[model samples]
Structures are given as structure tokens and as C-alpha cells.
Target: MHWLTLHTSVPMGQQTYETSIQQAVRDLAEPGWDFRASSVGSGRSAATLRIPQRVLDDRRGARLVGAATGLRHDLVHRFDLRVPPARGPHVLTMHDLPPMRFPDEGRLPAWCTEPLPSDVEVICPSDFAASEVTELVGARRVTVIPYGVRPSFRQPAPSSPEDQRALGVSRPFFVHAAGVTRRKNLEGLAEAWAIAAPELPDHELVLLGPPHGRREELFGHLPRVVLAGKVDLDAVGKVMAAAEAVVVPSTYEGFGLPTLEGMAVGTPVVAVDRGATPEVARGNALMTEPDGPSIAEALLAVGRHEIDRDDLVRRGLARAATFAWDTAARAHLDVYRKVTG
Candidate 1:
């Protein structure tokens, strides 16, 4: 079957969704399958079917593509939740329902609230997300194919002094690589930092991701908290490698990539028990409730050297090794086959 990936979304710098599609395509093509890609505008290739961004942006564009090129393509797959109408079968990857869960988050478009087409095949990165799709979108079929941590995170080079200087890493700190969104439970993290700040006086809490306007309003009082806005994944891997611990305080996640990335980098991770985190953590991370006190307790445990850090890191590495892009690619191929056949 000839599968084409429709990449219509612009790169907004939160690399998770974009990175997943890019990595998947790279691996999918690695096996020399008839994998093709279509974007807003790009040079034509044997494997690339160029589609204008404006043409795809139109409400009728998806169906028009099917009518125009249906003979050439067997299936279409979208990486994000924006599943426009198509004449033939297509797959949509609903990363999470943040727009539905936190209606005011503004991270996703309002169209996310609309129920997905019943005919469209849905793909989720985790079972937790699949449940949401089943309940909210009323999707009859949902496939859970977990994401893989990039190889850079798995065998990360140590954070050098220059890398530290670039990301404003001045001291030993706990890193939260996920952005400060409502679902991220920044309020809980702030309160938790307040509780744990006294315990680890020498350590700082590093917040990474794009800088939001409400950041200082929420975290300014905490002198120990540093807002290290938006570092690339390579820098994130290095920082995670050198951190005392990686923190994931989000109340919800689709796949919780950071949890797996932290583990891949061989760092002890502290994540909330809610959403897909526990599923991703898999007993490799110190799980805590999604509250200030619970997160604080976990933070204190890590800071005070109470838990078996070596054992935690060892287990994390072993567990993270299982989620390979090759595996994800094979699973995706299976989905494409089943969908088109």
C-alpha cells in the first residue's frame, strides 16, 4: 500500500508532535517502503507529493485531493488532530484532548472540541489518550502506539559547561522540560517548589519551554525557580543527563514523552500519577499524586537522597530502551495495512 502523510501544521516550536511525525517518516522510509509525504510546499521527490498549504487549508481541499489523486494513494495519515474531510480512509493521531480537558488552555484550536469523524481511524500515543478518544470523540476504533525517545536522549553526551551556559544552567537543579500549560499543573509545581525549596537550598528548579506571559506571575516568588525557556531537544537531553532529577508535574499527558526521555537519559524522574505518566513511568520513576504536597514529598525524597537513585536510573534505562522508533514504525505500518486493506 502507498501511504502518504499530510503534514499541514506549522512548526510551533513545541517539538513533540512534529518530531514524532518526522522521526516516524524517517524510520518508515528506512525499510524502503512506498511511504510518501505531502506538505504545504516542498520540492517534489519520488516519495513526496507536493500539496499547496492554501489548498489544504481549504475546507474542501482534503476531499479534493482524494478526488484528484485517489488512484495514486492508498491511504492518508495525519500527525495531529486536525483531520479535515477526505474521500478515502485516513488516520488521525490525537496526541491529547488538552483543548477539551482545559478548554481555556489556548494551546490547541477550538476545532479540537468537535467530535472526530466516525469513519476516520484514530491513533493515540497511549492507552490513557485512547480512552479519552473513545469517550470524547466516540471513536469506535483506537490504536495505541507509544512514542519512542530519540536516540540522542538514549545515549546523551554529558552536559558540558558551554551547554550549561547556553541554557542558563548555573547549578544543580531539577528540570521540568514540559511547557507551563494549565494541564502541566504549574500551580501545583509552584506550590511544590515552595515546599521543597527549603529542603534543597543549593538546588534550583529549572522550567523549560516557551515563555508564557503568566510565568513570572505564577513562579516569580520562588527565588530558587529558574525559567530556562525553550531549549532544543539536544540541549534538553544534555540538561536532563546532568540534572539531579527530571520532573513531570503535568496533570495530564497523551504519551508523556518527557517521562520516557528522562528515563532514556538515565536520570531519576519524578512524575505525577495522573494521565499517561504512570503508564510511561512504569515503576521506573518516583510517582506522586498531582498535588503540591505529594510532588514536594517526591522532590524531597530525591533531594535528600532517600531513594535508591542508582537502582532507579538503572531500571529507567532498561525500560526506556524498549520504546524504539523501529517498533513504532512497524506498528504504524501494521495500522496502515489494516486501514487500507
Candidate 2:
């Protein structure tokens, strides 16, 4: 059967929607399926990478193979004119339509996404995402299939005091590894952390992602901020395992995968009540306003042991278990089967 895989426009080497989709493809291979693929986004990190030049050129061509028909073509977050995917059965995965409202740094082309029917099935990763799709493109085309977490993220049985000390985590700490983006609202989170930092002087802040230029004033003043940039999945797991909690401070999200990942590692999560975050992290996390006091209070509550770790862990595992790459892949396979049937 012929299958068209759309690689995410996300940065290369980093795990994002594209990475999750690729994993689903790999896992789907275990089942009975042989299919070809194509995508518009460049998963490559740098065009200057050592890979052959022909491969790079082929990447763009392969994704656009069916674009002429106006479907399954190049899609962006904004309301752009795009060729729609050919008629028949097809599955389109939308992480979120962020660019249309609050755009990223890049300027979008004239054609971002093509028009499709309400009955067309579009896969989303969270309830909020599904709702948003319905709000934007209508309900018939939407389904909520969260990206699955790799099973390796279970907390390492709660490291002992000595072990925690060795990892440089002697006291309770919170991890915030959001990329430097406007939507991430790192500055707002930093403002909150700054307020709480003094009360809990010993508390640590493991800032795993890079610094955003726009929020220089807020992120600049923070002391004892551990900037762990571009960490691998394994290392991230370790980091999350050690944290008292993980904070997702984004103003919006298509799927708050990290919140679930943190919970998968048995770390309690605190997130703002916004966008798909509420859906993805619903039962497993502590939702709060984006203000400083709210963040501080949420962090403090989790730190003070007011939140039941066992319950959080149990609920998190259950919620997280709902999403499996195999499940996602199987759903895609069904679509393909119907497409080819």
C-alpha cells in the first residue's frame, strides 16, 4: 500500500510531532504493512549536514509528490492556501494550529493549509487539540490520539538520598525545560519562579532548555538556573525522575507531552490552565493560573508533600498508558487499510 508520511517542520534531532510520527511508523512496521512515505517539513537540523546533497533535494520532492492535487501537501499553522490531500481516506496529524493566532518567528507562505471537509478525519494529540480543530476546521475531521510515550520513562524507583545527592539534587526542586518561545511563556514562569525561589532558597530550578531573547529581562535575573539545553530522551528521563515536579508554563499547547513524560517518570507536574495542556495533563497534574503566586503556590504545594505522589503516579501512569505509539500506529494503519480497501 502507498503511504505518505509528513515529516514535521520541527527542528532536526529533537523529538517533536515529527519524531512521534516517525516512531509510530517504526512501531507500525511490527504489524503487517509495507508502505512508502513523504513529508513537507524538514526534520534535518542543518542543510550543511554531512548527508549527501541528493538526499536533501529528494526530501522536499518526495513530500510534494501529491501536492499538485491540493491535498496532503504543504501545511502550516496559519490560514494559508495549500493543495488539499487527494480524495479518499487519509489521516492528517495536527500537533496544533498555533501559527494562525499567535505566530512563531518565521513568516508563513501564502498557502499554509488546504481546505478539507468536516467529515475528513484529522488526528489531534489531546482533547483540547481535538476541540480546537473542531472550532477551526469543524468536528467531523477531528480525532484525539495523543502521541505516546516510550515506556522507558518510569521513575527509577525513587533514588535514595545519597543517589539524589550524587545527581546534585539534595533538596526538592522543580524542572522547567521549555524552549525559548513566546507561546512557552518562559518569562512568566521565570517571574513566578523568582517569587518562590526566595521562600525556598534551597529549592533548585533545572531549566533544561535554551534562553529566549525576548524575555531577557525576566530570565536574566534568575540565579541558580540550570540551563540544560538539547538533552537526549534518556537524560531528560533522568532529570525528570529527580525533580520534585515538572512545570509546563506554556500559554498554549497542541499536546503537552512533557507534562505526561514527567509524570511517566513519577514527577508531579504543575501547568498553567491554558490550551491543550489542560487536556493532556488534566487528571495527572496540578493546574494553576499563569501568575507568580499561582505558580509558586502550586510548586509549594507539591514540594510540601501536600500532593499525594502515589496517587499522582498512579493516575499519571493510567493517563499516560492511554497513549501508545502502537495504538496510534494501528489507527493510522486502519486509515491506510480503508484507503487501500
How many clashes in each candidate?
A: 0, 10
Q: Write the per-residue lDDT of candidate 2 for residues 1-341, one digit (tens) a residue.
A: 43445343353212455555556767656444444444333344342112332333453542343343234422211111121234445566666666566767354333343344654556777777777666665546565666777666655555466755554555677887666667887766887878778777778777665444544566656865655455565567777887888898888787877787877787788899998877777667888897778888888787677888878878877877776777776675565554446
Q: Estimate the TM-score for candidate 1.
A: 0.87
Off-target runs (Cα >4 Å) in candidate 2 are 11-15, 25-32, 39-89, 117-120, 137-140, 156-171, 211-216
Over the full model, what C-alpha lDDT does candidate 2 score relative to the true structure?
0.63
Show pairs that collide, candidate 1. none
| Cα-based lDDT for every prediction | 0.77, 0.63
Query: Which number leads on TM-score?
Result: 1
Residue pairs with backbone overlap in model 2: 70-83, 70-84, 71-83, 71-84, 71-85, 72-85, 80-112, 81-111, 120-141, 122-141
Clashes of 2: 10
Instruction: TM-score each candidate.
Output: 0.87, 0.78
